[model samples]
Target: MTTRDTTVAVFRPDDERLRDAVELVESLGATPVADPMLEVRETGASPRTDADYTVLTSKTGAEIARETGWEPGETTVCAIGSATAGALREQGYDVDLVPDEFSSTGMVELLAERVDGARVEVARSDHGSQVLLDGLEAAGAYVHETVLYELVRPEGAGGSAELAASGDLDAACFTSSLTVANFLAAAEERGIRADAVAGLADAVVGVIGEPTRETAESEGIAVDVVPENADFDELACAVVERAAPTYHD
Candidate 1:
């Protein structure tokens, strides 16, 4: 198999994210199928005010906080992963804590041991998880959650479903659990869920972390690769590694 024979599906919503995935796929000499599964729309909700600490779970959350002019003055900032931390730092917020595992459970463990009787604000998407709120509450922290954006499946996601059913995808890259879920949902809507799952099972499925891998597996799609460091570049490399025999031989 050659570069022309290797086709990868990049399922991230935002243009910047899609571009990054495309570039990574190109760098690996593979063709990228850009079909955004979800789109991010601002919710127009203001960030919580006067909190002792602020939590950001994704890059979208950090971007929303920056665009909304939310200041973290003297407040401890916590991020779920390095990407989120980098996004927060770009917005002039110093990330005080980043969990080693880069997941809600990881953040919970870190905060449960350190944060007590503190007011914490969580900024995330409308479909964000309740794990942080529940975990923080159980750890004795008052958590104020605000939805900064909404992750909705785009109307033209059927292309992805078709691609998945075509069985032409050599690898599929998923950055978040929502991406995996939305892709499966799109396939389900098109009555191609079984074919989509089979196609993904036949290809190299690269996930950013364990959570995304779990989500993909839960949808009956076999995940072949998960990067050690939850990053897109690493995920892309993992895909290339998994597909190497097809292209290299």
Candidate 2:
């Protein structure tokens, strides 16, 4: 196997996950640009009540729910993604279900068989799409949602612009539509024009799935990985395989 050094920019936020990514990059002998283009803010709380089921959509949701002392025993918690599931588990809740696809549709499919007219409460970001709740309600399940947090676009994508301008970035991974949109916005805020951004067309743009890929494609960035599933491992492997010439060529 050929090992080539890659410089990658992570446009999410300066969180524990960012620290983990930094460590991973160092382990691989690759450079990581910590450009925090998205800031997560806890903005709402779910009142303590008897809920039959709880849907944890993101780590932010899990954190906020944990902070607000959401009890796990009374409610069967279903995490939308594995990362969220891990977060919930760390917070002492046994995650009953995790979607294989890691999207609203996938969650809906799994939930359709599990919930037996249970009252479901969704803990999620304020600005996230309502597809999960809508799907659950359409399937004859009692569902309600509480906004746990909001994702604010950062002032600018400082690190991404610097890495891209120096032509050092081999790839950038976007996990969500918000990440892709805010990363580009941050690049523009740091004075990167359309032509300059487009010039990195050869750079591998790794996206989690179709929605994120669509957002990146709309911004004119070349997507090298639109994984069959939206799992984090799949995304990471896809990025490594596609960005390295030895793996793809």
Candidate 3:
């Protein structure tokens, strides 16, 4: 009898996130393949002083705000998810709101109800969605944005193209839209975009959230699973369940 070794490609941006994905993959008995497609770096921008409310869409945004020595003061801080709210709390800022749904659209809906005639500051990466800002503006709130971080593809990331096109991977996990976009960009750069896309079509494509799943679909890749919660452990479980039949065969 031969034992099957399942490989799961992890495309998280930074080391901290990659570590979590790797651990989850190992826990599910799958070999973890690091295919980091994006790198997060601070943009050295501070929180806006002219805003009455602040919005954070990711934990990285919260960390960037804290590192820049921005004081929340009386400004109502809104987060998109529990993890982002917890990060703000760790920095001693009282998070005033967190939407039940952890997406920009969800944040917009939450703020639309309470942010009329207010000035809002959106702190996030350079690639952050404009939906929250536009929605707030439509809801009668003046909005400003601070790009606290930037997402860039790491140098020499095309090496993963071979692995991605090899058809040996059992699953691929994407944590963000940028990761999905960058992965395809790297594959295209290596002249293996078609193979990579075909290989992924044959494998289970797991995304951390609906936004990423939508991005994958837009790029012509069919997604197989998306966890209820946008967490690495949940993504791991989803991938493990999808790959179980292959492992046992």
Instruction: Please say which candidate is ahead in TM-score: 2 or 3.
Output: 3
lDDT tens digits, residue span 1-249, model 1: 777578888888758988888888887778888889889999888677788878889988898898998888877889999999999888888899999988888899999967799998888988777788899999999899998999998887756567778887778888888888888888888888899888887788889877788888887888888889888888887788687655544
Could you tell me the TM-score of candidate 2? 0.86
lDDT of 2 by residue, 1-249 (tens): 243567666665778877876666545555666777678877757633567878888877877888888776677778887788888888777888788888888888888876657788887887666778888887778887788877888664566765665676777778888887777676677677464366457577788878788877887777877877666556666676666655444
Q: Given candidate 1, what's the lDDT at residue 246? A: 54
TM, every model: 0.94, 0.86, 0.93
Estimate, for each residue in 24-88, the C-alpha lDDT of model 3 and write its tens digit.
77766678888789888888999896688899888888888888999887788899888898888
Best by TM-score: 1
Q: Which residue pairs come into collision in candidate 2?
A: 157-186
Q: Looking at model 2, report the run of 10 residues with the lowest lDDT sum.
A: 193-202
Backbone clashes under 3 angstroms, per model: 0, 1, 0
Candidate 2 global lDDT: 0.73
Full candidate order by TM-score, most accurate first: 1, 3, 2
Better of 1 and 3 by lDDT: 1
- Better model by lDDT: candidate 2 vs candidate 3: 3
